[model samples]
Target: MTDYAFSSVNQLANDFKDAIKNADDDQKKVLKKAQAKFSLIERNYQIITNLYNNNMVDEQRPLYFFPSSQRLVAGKEEKGNAKLIVPFEFVGKKLYYGLTATGTHDLNPMPFNPRYPMVGLHANALNTILDNKLIHEVSKAWVVLIIIILGVVLAFGIPSLSPVQGGATIGGLLIGYTYLCFWLFSSQHIWLDLFGPAITMAVGYLGITIYNYIQEEKNKQFLKESFGTYVSPELIDQMYESGEEPSLGGEEGYHTAFFTDIQSFSAFSEKLSATDLVSLLNEYLTDMTDVLLDNKGTLDKYIGDAIVAFYGAPIEIENHELWACKTAIIMQDNLELLRQKWQSEGDRWPEIVHHMQNRIGINTGQMVTGNMGSASRMNYTMMGDTVNLAARLEASAKQYGIYIQIADTTYQPVKDQIVIRDLDFVRVMGKTEPAQVYELISETGQEPELYKKILPAFHEALALYRNQEWNNAIEAFKASDELEDMFPGRKTNPSRIYIPRCEHYRDNSPGDDWDGAWTLTSK
Candidate 1:
């Protein structure tokens, strides 16, 4: 049995041959007769263990061939079959066998693979025994402890960080925890199940990240639809992320209102086809609206050729009245440029194109502004006396033959910032109180030298006309008439407007309490 315990089957066969060579001629003759049977049975038994990939029975020794236990003491080739054991390539010392494990999945064999499937597990078991590194598996209570510790800490920590910071935090925690598990396994032969806690943190943070992404997209879409046409996209995005989301309700605050209308727009539309009308209006509105939005005005709604807008609501603005007045001034400048461009088109447009004009009005006062309407639909707009006053003033601009008009309140704060001339004190329809209206002369206070020379005489004429000095007022107004050419694109002049009024008042004057304010009879 001892002589047969060799590494390879060929080595054992050589030992068997040596034993037969030492036999006498008579014993060799008997051995040679039974050699074929012995070789077949031994090879068949060895092949059985490798076929199943496991050891089911201990190998038997050839004791019956020796005939007695006392004869087994002698060194002979006495074995039923030599047991095969898998070991390391260089290991020649101790070997492990019959390793036991519970509830393990079967080693699934793959085709075309030359190595046995169970070889890895066998090597691991053998290594554990050799290195004294068998794992002491963690208990149910230990796994639960890990879950509670990590879950409670991460729950409070993740939401306080931004998405990138939160992701980094979660990644760091998982890597650190895995390191701890590996450390315990190497140092103390302890194995911990990281799957439960790893899954908990992953699901928690991933859910939060997904929810935040959805909310951010919602905010961006809301801002784009609500304010894209009225302001810069960057401003809208910053306003949304500022954490003060605007809703339906409003706060009480002083604000400025603005209104504008194109003169004879309906008559212009009658001369053009629908497609041509839309193209012309699109270019005209885009130019005027760019000026309005550039000055930071919130566009309300368009009524035909008219636009209604306001400032200083939803978010407070500094000097909003001046912003409103400046936008009105810019509207006229852009309107003039468009008129020149259209005039150059000549026969490409209708005869009405030569007379393109716009009138604007601005007023400043306290008003309610918000998203106002039914529950199903609402519009962000202003309502109250200030809004109506601005609209009335714009409508009344045509009566005074001026392009831009603003209430006294709008002019007060912006007095030094803009060029303006007093138009008249007029009692607008539907109101008992009369407002002092001014014509917004220019965006910048800079004026032509010709205008500066004519304005002094006009102011003198206006003072005399108000005081009922008809003859002197007529002479002063006539002296200013030569400067009318400086105010281009108009068939009428200020002196021409007031000379008839002064004549009518002079002939019919007997009233004692007239305040000299014009009472407008129509819009």
Candidate 2:
């Protein structure tokens, strides 16, 4: 049988070679001659023709030699192309098929026949192309499997995960899929679609990622629009990070309450036109509010020309009282600068604008701090006696002609850091507790020369006044009042406020029950 096969192969091969050489690479002529030669071969031996010069046999339909008609015919288009990388090995002195260990199959179809070497080379190239087409067709099922796998996993998975997690999942899937395809092709001669599944995963991840990013930005914008004017930016960010909205609730905590009002806001309203008043208030409030936020205080609300804010709610500071005091001082200094600027702007503003004065009152104690008001319209604010006292202190500051007044509770924590003078011991309206009050002058090392000069005399006068030494206190207060004129910008002093009070007490004594705590009769 082997001998017959060789004889037939030799005869047919010789005819095909002659036909090929004569045709001089004309594919049609070669195919025509191949068909005639192939007719004499056994029925089982079929001729596979690669009609296209390129090795991709499956790109277009393959062509075949029909021995019965001695013609080449094109086959139906298939799923894959003929471009496989066939494996090989060497055994003994001959090259064999690398798929088997025993070297049972030869690399060339006719290994021993050397007369038609060109025929063997052509046969090997055609065999490789055919092998590639077979492998490609075989892998179609796997291609569908991968597409379904990636489509199902990524489509369902990406939406449930955060952007970072989604990206990681897509990357992991791509890496795993790539490795799988590479292993199958290199080790098992399987081909799988690489770009199709990868594209699916990337598109799914990107679509979800873009959606998530937009949602986050929208949430951030909402928070900014809702709370940007009232809450500090840092507090707003903290609220956002916590992923919870401010709800209606209250909790008691030790905090500092702040209240500020223009010294004569009503007068200004009466003096300037409505437009001019709003413009001035806008400028003044903007600058002062900037100073308030810079010091980490949360703005509670703006009641006309009055500003209400607090420290140690939603977030806490180590020493909230100290921060509240510092904020007050900075605001006053800022107002002074505004006053100077308004004064320099000529007569655009009334004389009061040139010396624009504001009063700030700060008190520290247990207070209820949280989102307050009806559910439909709520705000973050403070309530209780501490809050009331702060408001009262702000109103009463004008009585002493002082710009800043802090309760003794607020003064103690910041005593060493701030420069202050004892103002009075008084029970503000709506409260029975007679709290000691102090004037917040300046920072510790930054006190003015006049303040340093007047502090001693003022403090002595306060001690005597509190001790009920009314006649002596009056003398001390008068002496301190005299020192105010020595300063260049000698405005009214708190000492001048005390001198009259001491004179009243000396003339009309409050019986022995007077605890030296002056009780306020008005709000």
lDDT (C-alpha, whole model) for all candidates: 0.76, 0.77
Give the C-alpha miss distance for residue 460 in model 1, angstroms: 3.6
Clash pairs detected, candidate 1: 62-79
Candidate 2, residues 142-168, lDDT tens digits: the string is 777878877788668677877677778
Model 2: how far residue 347 lies from native, Å: 3.3
Q: What TM-score does each of the candidates earn?
A: 0.65, 0.67
Task: Give me the candidate number with maximum lDDT.
Answer: 2
- After TM-score superposition, what is the CA distance of residue 423 in candidate 2 from its true location, in Å? 2.3
Task: Give candidate 1 regions above 4 Å deviation.
Answer: 1-136, 139-157, 160-207, 229-232, 249-251, 273-275, 463-471, 485-495, 503-516
lDDT of 1 by residue, 1-523 (tens): 2344557767767766776798888877666544544675575565565544555335433332234543222222344233232222113564333323343453444464433345466777778888887789999898999899877767787878987898899999999988988898889889898788889888878887887789789878887888777655645765776765556765456999999988768887789899888888888888888887788788888887788888875566789988888787678778878878888998888767766888888999988887788888888778899889999999888776677889999989988888777778789988889999887877555665766877787888889888889888888888877665534435566667778777888898837687878788889
User: What TM-score does candidate 1 reach?
Assistant: 0.65
Best by TM-score: 2
